[model samples]
Target: MKITFLGTGTGIPQDGRVQSGVLLDTGKNLLLFDCGCGVLGRIHESGYEHKDIDAIIITHLHLDHVGDILALIKANWLLGKTDMRIYGPQGTKEWFEKTLDVYDYLRDRFTVEITELSPEEEFIPQGTEGNCNCNIRSAKTAHTDNSLAYRIESSHKTVVYTGDTEPCQEVMELAEDADVLIHECSFPLGFPMTNHTTPDLLTLMMDEYPLTAKKLYLTHLYPQMQGRYREATDHIRKYYKGEVIIAKDLMVVEIQDD
Candidate 1:
C-alpha cells in the first residue's frame, strides 16, 4: 500500500500546505480521502490524474473536508471518467444531492454512487468494474456526531487515517497494529481546543493507547502550527515510540509488507 498526502492544511491555507486530501493506493485501487479545496491542483502536482481515483471517502461534511468533491467529480467528467463512488458517514447522500442542486450541468454529467456508512461499517472497495480490491473499515471518531476514521488494508499492510478528531478511543482501536497512522494535529501543544487535536491531548491518549503503528504522520495542520511544528512532534515523541512526522503536501509514504 502507498499513501500520498495531497493537501495537509486546514480551512485556512498556509505556505506549503493546501487543504485536506489524501490519496491511497493499495497496489491495485486508488482511493481518495477528503477532497477539500486545492486538492484537484495538488492531485495534479502529485503526479496523479484526477480520473484515476476509484473512490472518495469523506470523514465529515465540513467544508475543509468535502469542499471540492463536486469539483473532483466535474474534473473527472471533463476527462471522460464517469463512474465515481463515495463512502461517507450518515447524511452523505443528502449532502451530495443538496450540493449538486446548485449546478444543473453537473447533475447529469457524472454517475456517482454515494453510500452512507454507519459507524463501524466494513467493506471491500472494488474499483469501478471490479478492477481492484482493498478492504476498508471505519470507526466513528470524535470530531462530530457522524465523523469517522478509516483503516485500509491490502496486500498484508494496514494504514489508519484519522480525519479530524480529538484523541479518541475509537481512533486508537482502529490504529492498532496498523503500519502507518495518519492522524490530525490541528494545533500545537498546550493549546486548549475542542473538536480538534493538540499535541498534548494526543500524547495523553498515547499513554493509554500505545500506538501500534510503526510511524505516525500528523496532518490537517492549522496556522497555529506554523512556527511550532518541531515542538509538537518533539512533545509527542516522549509518549510515542514510533516516528512522528508532520505531513506536508505531496508527501508520499510507501507501505510494504514485511
Candidate 2:
C-alpha cells in the first residue's frame, strides 16, 4: 500500500500546506481520505488523476475535511468518470444532499453512492473500477460526535488514519501494532486547545497507551505549528521508540507488507 499526503494543513491558511486530504494506493485501487479545499489540485500535482479515485472515506463533516467533495466529483464528471462511492460518518447522506441542493445543475448528473458509517462498522472497498480486496474498520474519535478514525488493511500492511482528534482510547485501539499511524497534531507543545492535539497531549498517552505503530506521521497542521516541528517530534521521541514524521503536502509513504 502506498500513502500520499495530499494536503496537510488545517482550516487556517499556511505556506506549503493545504487542508486535509490523503490518498492510499493499495496497489489495485486508490482510496482517498478527506477532500478538503485544495486537495483537487494536489491530486493532480501528485501525479494522480481525480477520475481514478475509487472510493472516498471521510473522517468528519468539518469544512476543512470535506470542502472539496463536490468539486472532486464535478471534476470526475467532467472527465466522463461519474461513478463513485463515498463513505463517511453518520449525517453524511444529509450533508451531501444539502450541499448538492444548492447546485441543481449537477444534482442528478452522476452516480454517487454515499454510505453513512457508524463506529466499528466494517466494510470492503472495491475500488471504483478495479478489484481491491482491502478491509476497512473505523472507530469513533474524540473530535466530533460523528468523527471517525479509520484502520485500513491490505496484504498484512495496516495503516491507521486519525482524522482530527485529541488523545483517545478508541483511536489507540484502532492503531494497535499498525505499520503507520497518520495522526493529527494541530498545535505545538504547551498550546492550550481542545478537540485538537499537541505534542504534550499526544505524549501523555505514550506513558500508558504506548503507541504501537512503527511509524507515526503527524498531519492536519495549523499555522501555529510552523516553527515547532522539531520540538514536537522531540517531545514524542522522549517516550516513544518510533519514527515521528511531520507530514507535508505531496509527501508519499509506501507501506510494505511484512
Candidate 3:
C-alpha cells in the first residue's frame, strides 16, 4: 500500500502546507481521505490525476475537511469523469444536497453516490468490488458529533487515519496494531487546545492505552506547529515505542507485505 500526504495543514493557512488531504493507493484502488482546500491542486502537484480517484472518504463536514469536495467533483465533471463515490458520517447526504442546492447548474451535471456511514460500520468502497482487496472501518471521533476515524486494511497492511480529534479511546482501539497511524497534531507540545490534538494530550492517552502501530505519522498541522516538529516527536517517543514521523505535503510512504 502506498500513502501520500497531499495536504498537511489545517484551516489556518501556512507556508508549504495546504489543508487536510491524504491519498492511499492500495495497488487495486485509489482512495482519497479528507479533500480540504487546495487538495485538488495538490493532487496534480503530486503527479496524480484528480479524476482517477475512486472514492472519497470524509471525516466530517467541517469546511477545512470538506472544502474541496464540490471542487473535485466539478473538476472531474469538466474532464468528463462524472461518477463519484463519497462516504462519510451522518448528514453526509443531506449536506451534499444542501450544498448542491445553491449550485444548481452543477447539480445534475454528474452522478454522485453518497453513503452515510455510522461508527463501527465497515464496508468496501464502491468500484473496488471484484478485487475487494481494501476494507474500511469507521470509528466515531472526539472532535464533532459525527466526525470519524478510519481504519483501512489491505494487502495484509493496516493504516488508520484520525481525521481531526482529541486523544480518545475509540480511535486508539480502532488504530490498534495498524502499520501506520496518520494522526492529527494540530498544535505544539504544550499548546492548550480542545477538539484538536497536542503532543502532550496524545502522549497522555498513549500512556493509558498504548498505541502499538508500527509507524506514527503526525499530520493536520497548524502554524503553531512550526519549528516544534522535533520536540513533538521526542515527547511522544518517550511514551510510545513506534517510529514517529512528521508528515509533509506530497510526502509518500509505502508499506509492503511481509
Instruction: Report lDDT per candidate.
Output: 0.89, 0.92, 0.93
Whole-model alpha-carbon lDDT for candidate 2: 0.92
Q: List the residue pairs that clash in candidate 1.
A: none
TM-score to native of every candidate shown = 0.98, 0.98, 0.98
lDDT of 2 by residue, 138-223 (tens): 99998999999999999899999999999888988899999999999999989998899999999887777889899999999998
Higher-lDDT candidate among 1 and 3?
Answer: 3
> Which RMSD does model 3 reach against the true structure?
1.1
Candidate 3 has a TM-score of 0.98
Note the residue pairs that clash in candidate 2. Answer: 54-128
**Which segments of candidate 1 are over 4 A away from where they belong?**
none
Off by over 4 Å in 2: none
The stretch of ten residues in a row with the least summed lDDT in candidate 2 is: 124-133
lDDT of 1: 0.89
Model 1 scores a TM of 0.98
Q: Give the clashing residue pairs of candidate 3, or none.
A: none
